[model samples]
Target: MSLALPLQRTEVLVIGAGPAGSAAARQLARAGFDVLLVDQQPQGRDKICGDGLIPDAHKALARLGLLEQVMALAQPVSHVGCIAPRGGRIDVPGELAVLPRRELDNLLCQAAQDAGARFLAPARFEKPLVNEQGRVCGAQVRIGDDVHEIACDWLLLATGAVPKALIAAEMCERHTPSGVALRGYVHAPSMVGRIKAMEVVWNKAVRPGYGWIFPAPNDCFNIGVGVTDSHKAVSGKGSKKELNLRAIFDAFCANYEPAAALMREGKLLGELKGAPLRCTLDGARWSRPGLLVTGEAAGSTYSFTGEGIGKAMETGMLAADAIIQGKAKQWNDAQLREAYEQSLRALKPKFDLYQRANRVNAAPWLADLLIWRAKRSPRLLARMSGVLRETSNPGNLVSLKGFSRLFLE
Candidate 1:
């Protein structure tokens, strides 16, 4: 594709209107750059997520200057209810809230537009346009039946999880998804006030996976299950990993009483939906000449909690910062890529710890151990809360040292 007589030109083209893309676009546009934010779907599209915003998310929202606004629209909660196999339960205190993606994403996208970024809807990225020098100069975007070449100095791919967009950009390193998740909203008025915390449930029946019930605004409960291969599934050594997400979801609804109670008392708002997750910060090449990958396209989700909203926004801001700094400092593309990748390197250890924490999902008994210890030891419970705050390491709660600390410390 050629950029000759291109009708659209932007200094930065951010694909996808999710938290990451919107956040990046907002910052770039606020900095007085020509930014164009596009997404295949129209505004307010429902994204598959647990809808729980923990402390880490709070901090990110605060930095975006949207914490107060989001909290006003969110279901503010003080704790996360963690349930173990055999039904042991504990509420870990932290800064937490629930807001549906349908609302949260649109709020961020609108914020980007308000910040002077041009926004386009129903725009799909077909493929990148590479210059003669092998640098990405633009992309071909499909809108309805017509396709247009959009020229840009930099492209940030924030298209989450689905690999087709990544493949088109040659950014997809692995075709296999890091994990899969299922979720649905149920309108349970009776349970709305009753279920206070964002509840996470672990059990053997959903090995390599877990379940959650987050109370949202308007008496809606977000309930779901997920299976991830951050480390290994309960599947034996060298075994092919296959998953039936629906079956696992069904198993979760059956074995977990909270999910069952919610479903029985409330009607499902829509069908249970599933989406793939790219995790471990290992799904794609971080950067190339004139282009950078962020968000779930860069594998931003955590394997342990399937939490990515905050990290997605963080990486988006990081990407915007890289471009801004590169322009101001007159740095080369290599420097731009290095700065972004190094920033991610600082975050990769946390992603690793989250992946290590996935072992508890595989071995549900570990949850029982932690809950058992946490109930007796306020110190242990505080550490778990610190994990939500990103002040403590998640791996410590699941490691051998973690296990020893249950008895010793």
Candidate 2:
């Protein structure tokens, strides 16, 4: 028997209680808005991810005043060791943090609830509720066979890259192919090997996509590979047998000397899982009437590195800021759309530059040369690391002037 509850109404309805949704709801609730945050899974569910938070992510956490919380639960990563095709490598100094996604997501969601947002878990989103004029007014959700209509003055979609949510909300016709990645964890203490830096490997084996061995808390490591769908078109590598990310990951783990030696003793923690990555935000409609889309669903993931956590949270904050401020000014849908679009436009520089860098790195030779040059110059290496931290501009890293200074100067 379903329990009859009062009609669910909120000033803001946030779908998908991941980092993005939780962050947005937290901010809105802090501003005294009645926000409803919902997710498909219960609290603290494991989310497949690299779990590495680069400097940019740290900045976002700091903005939310949760840096201390993350610091307490995270493994410190102080440098990045990037390997290029043909054995070119560089070690750049920086600060990064890693923790299990299960912990991180739950912490963020709990923070939201503490700030006054209402959270509903194990509630699956069915579709966006649209009014007669096609404006999103709320969401249709199901909680254990009892359907609920969550009416809201504003709706925000933070559903990550899930295609079902996108299609249900009419955000995208079909999921546009962007990037694919496979990752798994290994809990081998013997494999720790005093390696404190995050390792990125690029070789012929995983051309166009890169492999990473990131240290996790408790002496484990997260290993993964990411490949953009446009790799073949840009690299001019003619279509051949389709590359299986899992098979490639296995071959790399079995053949790559470092990874092979480590995995020989390390046990895989779980089945290797793969997911699609969204690389661009240009095609998505950010705001329509009363609805706003953020996170990976809006293609906020970085193109080169396939890191979306930081960008996802940033977009979430942007959406919340727009709504909070718009409500103050009593702005209509047109004004709200303008504010949200402009906020996204402000982020275009980084995304555009990252795309260019992605294309530049598609060529193994150029990547090799860049890494080789950085290895020889400490100052250049620091600059390269700054890009990962978002302190330096990515456009400069891929610019001819920057290359000359790092290589010829």
Candidate 3:
């Protein structure tokens, strides 16, 4: 991963072809900027995720003009099933769907390409090229054996939760991940009808995280357990975490009847895979001179639900919009970077509220209370649906006052 190479040029060099990168690349390319999207992996690579596309994700896809195309290939869901520790449940209706990341990311990348962005697969980003003033001017990437230095006016880092590329670019603030998760696919037409909604289970066994069983395409269910708050301490001593994701996943299937039934009846489509999560949007510097961080690289995933897809795309487009406006207004580098930081800062309050909501995952009894109340109160269920849709502040549901009011309201 050395840096010496030829001087290929583009206005934008987008590293990591995830939702964030592709979204940014597509927008910038469509706006007439020369953009290139690069990924370490080739197309068709599977990304570990729960695969549940909620209302916010649907909205983002619609903004990108890919909603209909994506839904055509996705497994439509009626509602999200919430399961509590004691097995009590509630179904909160919302616009939801599930499609494996293998297809979702590929579709996004293809959309970016169709929108006129150059794409290079198996192209690994080595490091950023900085000018004399320390502003990132371009990047050096390794494609096969050759190293090529591609110059760009702006660089968008969308490298997901991995810290290596962030470290190379000197944009990473926290080396440790905010969380970790394990994902697996199970194929069972019999279980498909049985588990109709996107089922999310919270129990003491999976505290600080949760388990999900969502129907994916081709009679498969995407099943996984995510330790969303594992990066922090249970008490106040340290934030460093020592977790066994596999053990927790096993316990989830053992303790939850639906998960157990799915495991018993379905054929596990593949061996389980794990991925790191950066949540609460605090793990990285959002922007510096001539560079911006997007997606999980900027902590787009929610600490409460481990859902990052929509937020990633939203942040990516936000970053692109910043650059697009900066150029139109002829803003200085400092002004442009400050604007991006301000935009990211505006998202902080919501992310903090989501972190507060993570308490439900840490405390199983709290989930039970919410489920109990939600089943009894239509108002509570609507609020839960609102939270999923990103229209309601999660704090309202997790705060003590909100819980107490649930019974009376």
Candidate 4:
């Protein structure tokens, strides 16, 4: 039976109830805005991701006042173990945590509810609704078999990488700077001794990408592989032209010693699944009048590590801040635009640093050399660690000046 919903109105309509939407909704609601958060899933669902929370993620959660809740559910990790193509390993010290997205997303949504945001689950976004002036004023959504319209003063899209809604709304022609990534869980309690931290492995075949084994709560490990869209295009001809990320992941487990060791004893928890990783901070629109795009939908993932959760949440909060600031002064759309763009500018330095890391990954030899250098250079290792923590930029490690200071000096 089609259950029709009544006409709904909200000060802010946040589409997608992931970290980005939930965070934005929580902030805006707490600040006295009537926020409506929606998602297609009836209950919080698991997503294909490493699910590791580095220091920056911690900061974003803390800002949303849900850090303590997340920390309680996460498995603590203190270091990152990086493996070069030739089997050389380097461990960088930092605080890290991993929690399944199923749990994390639910907790974030509950937090948003507690802060006064109304939630509409199992509601799928159809498209953006624009005013006569071509300004987006709200969204069209479908719940079950009934379609409904949600009118809002502002619309925030936290839809994450794919850009289906973005394209439907005429926000972009298509997604640019995208990559394919695969992830799955494995139950390996006995292998915990060898896997004490997040492990990242690089192989010659998976240039411009890498494989990861992140320890999760319980005896599970999130294992995955990723490769950029550009890398896949130039990979080869014929059937080889299409890059099989799963095959790449399987080959990585077979070749990488640490990963191989775990797979031997660990049982697969579920089927491995893959998705498009929307990265590289380019060619995505952030705002169009009453609407704003935050999170991966706005290209917030760091190209260097393919880490999106933290940046995603950060962009959400930034959008909320801009909205709150504009509301205070009753600013016009032009003013809101300025505030939002100003907020996005804060990420430029970090994004630039990630771009540099992308270049390093393109040249495997240089990245491997840097990994080797980190094994012997404490200063370099510390700086590398700081990049993950958001205290240092990745560019500092690969820049000519930084290279000279570390190796030549």
* TM-score (all chains, Cα) for each model: 0.96, 0.93, 0.96, 0.94
Candidate 2: TM-score? 0.93
Better of 2 and 3 by TM-score: 3
- TM-score result, candidate 3: 0.96
TM-score between candidate 1 and the true structure: 0.96
Residue 136's lDDT within candidate 3 is 95
lDDT tens digits by residue: candidate 1, 6-86: 388989999999999999999999899999999999988989999888877888888888899899999988899999997
How many clashes (backbone N, Cα, C below 3 Å) per candidate? 0, 0, 0, 0
Ordering by TM-score: 3, 1, 4, 2
Steric clash pairs (candidate 3): none
lDDT per residue (tens digit) for residues 290-391 in model 4:
988888788787776788888888989999999999989989998997889788887877887887877665676766788888888888888888888888
Give the alpha-carbon lDDT of every model: 0.89, 0.80, 0.89, 0.82
Better of 1 and 2 by lDDT: 1
lDDT, candidate 3, equals 0.89
Segments in model 3 whose C-alpha atoms lie over 4 Å from true places: 1-5, 233-240
Which residue pairs in model 1 clash with each other? none
Error of 1 at 341 (Å): 0.7
Off by over 4 Å in 4: 1-4, 229-241
